[model samples]
Target: MVGGGFAGLWAVRALKSAPVRITLVDRGNHHLFQPLLYQVATAGLSAPDIAAPLRQILRRQKNVVVRMATVSTIDADAKTLELDCDGGNETLAFDYLLLATGATHAYFGNERWAAHAPGLKTLDDALDLRRKLLLAFERAESETDPDARDAWLSFGIIGGGPTGVELAGTLAEIARHTLQGEFRNIDPSRARVRLIEAGPRVLASFPEDLSEKARKQLERLGVEVSTGTPVKDITADGYRLGETFVPAKTIVWAAGVSASPLGECLGVPLDKAGRVPVEPDLTVPGHPDIFVAGDLATLKQANGKPVPGVAPAAKQMGKHVAKAIRARLKGVGIAPFRYRDFGNLATIGRMAAVVDLGAWKFSGIVAWWFWLLAHLFFLIGFRNRSVVLLNWSVAYWTHQRAARIILGGDDTRC
Candidate 1:
């Protein structure tokens, strides 16, 4: 493992029962719960609540060894992996290499704004966003100038995917209901949340009716949803979408993603998005000893459409790769990896969500309840799930966010 995202974690879990000696290497020590990363940014949850130490999680597993290191390059010809550690460079040889290294937020050709508007993919990013959001409110409350106050209160979100939509909705709820009575001079309720989507509709992957319903739910929460609008530029003050300039102090980018550079390091054939092109068995072409899974690999189905880069898909790929490795080691014929779609769910706000399960489609409070339960159930540990549930229950009843403290950092240093 070269990454510690959902894919890498699942890959390790699936390979636990195998007889292979697994050495999992990642930059971070903990495996983060990415779906609820928005909650961390919106101050509904803390870092430790959604992250488990990698060492702690696999401590008792005899076949697994967790190393906190960054992979610099892979000598595929020599079958050696080069890693950078605290002390010095280290190399390890692998009979079967599995690349679960995942994707990262793409800046859409403008990498400069990454410093100003950070995307939430890791625990550190979430904490930074939380700090920026809460600090904006605190600064806005004390600002006497109307224009500056408005700029401070304005929040801009790019993209209309599930992550972007959920963040926009939760932020709206926080500003309107949670912090309504907290501020003295500033009405946090008046804070602007503008969601920018270049596509024709939000949640384009979901059903058209469900997308419309999500849009309505966002509007009800006071979020300004702008579809078919492309953000041309971003600055310290805000972003420029063609002729219009939206002045927002806090900007969240959830637009696009690109696969890790590990694939390039291996010199494998990659798709347009820089993902490794894998066979139906999830093995790299010409290298049956090496397997690629999760976001790092692009596998096309019989219908010619590429597999979706969702958590469930990544988990399924991880397990399939592990099984294939085991089968190959036993000298048995391996089955081709097949992805099973497990439906999609996206929450707009409190008591508002949309779930599509092929034959069955649900919306409104029931969908929201299901979404909450499903997320809670997927959380790694019992203690984490219990704490998250307790926190959510308190927030639901009291309309207050518990982790709204703002640490210091300007837009330039984000």
Candidate 2:
């Protein structure tokens, strides 16, 4: 198993009672709850609240061994993997290989923009962003020049996806409510928060009406939502919003993502996004012993639409691959994999969200509550759920975020 994410972890857990021995390898030591990652980036929750150590999680299972290393090379014909660790490089042999390696941010050919606008994908990214955000306010408070101070107070989020929406909404709340009356020279409520999307509407994957509702909800939170506005260039000073250059100190890139380059190592033709077009059974073409799941694999449903890369789909794919492996050991053929659409949910701001469950669709405070509960239920471990629930409760009632401390040594110069 390659990756400690939802796909790899679920696959490992599902194979606990099986006859085969397993080795789970990943570079990161902890399994992160990515859906709530934005909360950590926005100071709503701490890092540990959404992450669990891998060894601790798999301690009870005796059939599995966890290795902390990066898989550098995969020789499919020899069924050997080259692992790079702190000590040295080593080759490990495997009977069956599962590549659940996840994805990273895509700059869409403007790699230099990454230095100015960072994307939130991991714990480090979140912490760095939190520091940048808090320091932006602090820098603004101490600035002497009016235009420089305004630029320091300005913030821009470049994507309209779930992460972008959640970040923009929470940042607005922090400026207006959390940091209220904290600084004498500047009113934090006057900070400018902008959400820019090149597309025609936000949450393009959702129903049209829900997208409209989400836009309105963001606007109500004082977020300047700009749609159909493509970003031409991004620099330390600001970004080019279509034809005009907007000055902003902090910029977040949540626009696009590409699959891990490990897919190319498999020697298979990949899609435009660098994702492997897997077989119906979630196996790589011409290599039944090799499986790919999560954001790394791409599969089209009967309806001709690609399967969404949400947590549910990744978990299901992981379990399906595990089932296939078990059947293969018994010389029994399993049926083709089928994805069950479980609907979608996106939160805009406080007491605002949109839910689409096929025939049933809803938005507003009720949807927000539903979103909260659903995330709590899906979070791993009792302690995590408890801590997150408590933090959220405190923030909801007090309108103040709990984990607002900026620790990293990030550049906050205006």
| TM-score against truth, every candidate | 0.97, 0.99
Write down the RMSD of all candidates, one decimal each.
Answer: 1.8, 1.1
lDDT of each structure?
A: 0.88, 0.94
Candidate 2: residue 125 lDDT (0-100): 95
Residue clash pairs of candidate 2: none
For residues 211-244, what per-residue lDDT tens digits would candidate 2 score against the true structure? Answer: 9999999999999999997999999999999889
Candidate 1 residues lying further than 4 Å off, grouped into runs, are 408-414
Worst 10 residues of 2 by lDDT: 405-414
Clashing pairs in 1: none
lDDT of 1 by residue, 165-251 (tens): 999999999999998788899999999998999999999999999999999999998999999979998988999987998888889
Among these predictions, the greatest TM-score belongs to 2
